[model samples]
Target: MNASAKRLVFLLLPVLATGCARTAVEPAMSRPDFVRGEPRVTVHRDHDDLLSAGLGLAGLAGTPVPFADPAHPTAPELRRRAIQASWKGIADLGPLGGYGQAYGAVPAVPGREYQAFAWVPGARQPHRVLLQVPDGFDQAKRCLVVTASSGSRGIYGAIALAGAWGLPRGCAVAYTDKGAGSGFFDYADDSGVALDGRRARRGEAELEFTPPPLSAGAGVAVKHLHSGDNPEADWGRHVLQAARFGLAMLDRAYPEQAPFTPQNTHIIATGLSNGGGAVLQAAGLDDAHLLAGVVALEPNVQLAGQGRPFYDYATEAAIWLPCALTDASFDATPFARAPMTRGWPQRCASLHAQGLLTAATPAAQAAQAYEHLRAAGWTDNAMQVAATTTAFDLWRAITAGYASAYLRRDAAHMPCGFRYAGMKADGQPGVADTATRAAWWSDSAGIPPGNGIGLLGGTDASTDPTLAGERCLRALWDGDGADSRALRAGIDATAARLPRTDLPLWVVHGADDGLLPTAFTSEPYVAWLRAEGRRPLYWKVPHAQHFDAFLPLPGFGERHLPLLPYGYAALDRLWAHLYEGAPWPTQSSTPKGQPRGARSLTPAMLGLGAN
Candidate 1:
């Protein structure tokens, strides 16, 4: 039989089936007729359009419908009018998954032009919309906006997990290509040519548990990468565009829907590493209606201030640039020393001549050097002086280049899985020694440098002679002082305007985090928040390196099963708070109790930190 005839025959065969069997086939094709026991909304979709329809249907069922727009009106009137319009729109778009029709892509940015896909399970086709929010309504809700760095390959494991968790809790997720057609995974692509005049260099191998490339219809991708080489501006624009897109999407989907409305919605911005930095910048700049909270994992805040010439000194001079120091006991005077007045080489000679090395023996100096290198690699020698230089004459001349290089590569590299032998967790003849005791110091002592302790001693406000000098010089040269000031002012202003203590925040960090030391980052932040009367939840997972806590089951190497129990439980608490408006949970006050790793951090602590 011909193809058409055979398809017809197959269709008839289902109808001809026994009574119970026939009923199943009928309901599968025809528009759902909600019977007494049927779902309020039944999702049905073809394979190609399933995800979009599924998400839209979920949004409809979970919240109130939206209203339509009205003519020109006052600010309050516009908001009320929009709310009504959104409700009506949703009501009219009722029970979305009946017809065989698929939802089309939506436009998220009007003038900019972008397409978006919304999915709800069981929908017959995808609901696609083109987003273009009205000029005044650029910051609406119901949008799923994403921002990433230029080289960011797209959403990966932990980030994807966050999206999955947020979807069920009332989020419509979307991402920007950041102008790089390839998502975050593009870095793995091989482009180098081979010497044989044939393709030999392959794309770098994929990282473990990396997410797959997204289909054209799955989400929207915007081309916003600029032509200039300004990474900061590029990043700032990426964030702003993401926020704008999110607002436009919200307007299109929910129109006038409340809670999801621009002013009422609780927008939570989060990202990892560079993406995390984008979220912070976006939130800091436009916290109104766009960002309610921020979760920046391994964010690079240091780069934000690198424009200052004072901070650029270290990068200018190659001193202490290659070592990885992490000792907590060493004094800070040596590391923070600047180049001598006479000259770099002359300074070294003078220090050698003075025999100042005898005062702080090589062993003691090694301990200090090792500590800084272990945590943050090497400090730029120039920046070190600007940050903490005490005696430019004596300390600057003492060139510790040999010790720095030895500890940086040979000694420090071995302990944390490198081949070289160094310190071990138990102070054994291995690299792991540093990892073990480092957590204790971070948890018990506020960051060493800031607290005026350990290797960073004398660098604090009291001892550092160049502290004021550096600050004044940096402020004088900062061209973007206005932008920096605006960001700080925005944060402060937002804190004052939205002084609601009801929102609970939680923070989670791995004790052995190498990239951003927990001791210097989150731990200190949490302490400040607490001192300010905000009971922030803080959890320090031992042995759990940064990003490890968020890994999926059969982790990167399948070495340890990812512990998502804490994350899961924290979500439950969050849902309760969001839906029932329950009282927020308190911060964990108990001392260290659990063993190192994800499980060591409890749900309570996670929830606390999330606040």
Candidate 2:
């Protein structure tokens, strides 16, 4: 099909599908018949107590401890036997442009027997499926499918929270391996290289450089040691495939429970960082089954263009334009030029004309731009630049890869790019113009950093050395393009569909988030959603970086300004929205605690301590 035709089909398909699949209730109506009552049993207090330990624990456990017995039956064994019995019933099928494949089961859902396969593009082997059947499944009122993130599989803590806690009362739960079985990273050894006619095996290094601040020599060492072209590509695919497979498995598993209809099955998908991205992508594309809602704790969708580049507006513009203008050994010009629009240069020039260029030195400024492009795996050599001026010569000695390495380091420290003043040389305002500050504060204030999350400082099971290796392997194997675009589009589309309102979206971010900025957390999307009449309940926790919220640590202090207590309160209010389906009480309340009934708050009212 022609480009226009393809675009038309793409746009029409979702609308048509959306119309046909429209829920019985209005999309905006939050009320549901299944309101959860106060817990009949005490909620699992700490992460460790939720799931039975041992291989039974699938996914990241919070703190290190002995393995517990399986709380649920060994349905995984039964499922394996079932798959073996009806192997011919399943077929591998590709979807979303062959980015991944789906295993189809005969009769889809509500079938007694299940058939499914896991497909990831570059993995040497497809992920194996493991299933767990909750106790008294035949007696349960509902069924749930929990999808886990990397390191989450095989870890007792994460599984318990997701499977035990996340599942509504009277529901049976099942989860997948997420391609990381045994709670450890897989090690690949090369058998081809040999000495004295004997095969020699060497353990491949799987851990990529930890999020930045690399020693001065670390970059060179990494370049020489690391084999994967893009770290994200390495692990992203497995996670995507595993997630997709998990959903398919759910389709089969859903049939066994009491309330087996599609409408009644509650499919709540969630994940942290990579897994979070998977949740967003899956939600945007698939509406089948019981995909009730999505909760992405800390997703990593690239959000650039918020700051200025290192080169002056004219020079960078020329470099980012239609030809190669930079002399950098690595041809990043093309990659840099793509994705960036002409408007970026224009905006930069406008800012420069207004004296915003004096904010930071060329090196620091260039570092920010370089980091953004590099993370996306695009280099200056990829851009088409012209050699009109001596500008390209300056960048010649500075390799795109080298620049990218430096930028990655910087990104690890502050993924959002430094605040305007922070990016400046003398702490003088560069991009901190009122407009910039407004944008920054607008995005920052809504998503508070998560505090005391265990994923940081290597305490969380998700960050277990063994799990990290598995994650690295997954990243190395999965191609990155499909997941990235899917996440971006999903967020944008979700934002577009929301009703306009100023209600905050309670967002949690790890203070150590290395991928996207904390602002990228549903805040901007929520803000955009508010513009469409939707109210978001936004909040953040300190030291809770991406993925950390999913992996809580014990006794770590809150790392942000408002700290943990305030963070929990914010979460409580958000939970009200999710459970009670009521607009935040504060949303319509005046400063004096008087009800205002959906009226937007005034600056004075918000500024006042009341309400």
Best by the lDDT measure: 1
Best by TM-score: 1
Every model's TM-score:
0.39, 0.37
lDDT over C-alpha atoms for residue 379 of model 2: 31
Off by over 4 Å in 1: 1-151, 155-159, 168-170, 176-241, 250-260, 302-368, 371-504, 527-535, 549-572, 589-611
lDDT tens per residue, model 2, 1-611: 24432222111110010111111111121111211111011111112112331112121111112112111112222122112211111111111111011111111111111112243444322233323333233333344444443322221112322443333233333343333222111011111111111112233222211222333212111211122222222233333343333334344444343224435544445444444444444443453323544445545433223221121122233233212221233233222332322233333333334353432443333444444444543333222222111121212111221122222222222211111011223444222222222111101111111000001111124312222222222222232555334323322322212321332333334433322334434445545545556554444333333322211111111221111222223433444454468665434321121111233222222122332
Clash numbers, per candidate: 92, 79
Whole-model lDDT, candidate 2?
0.28
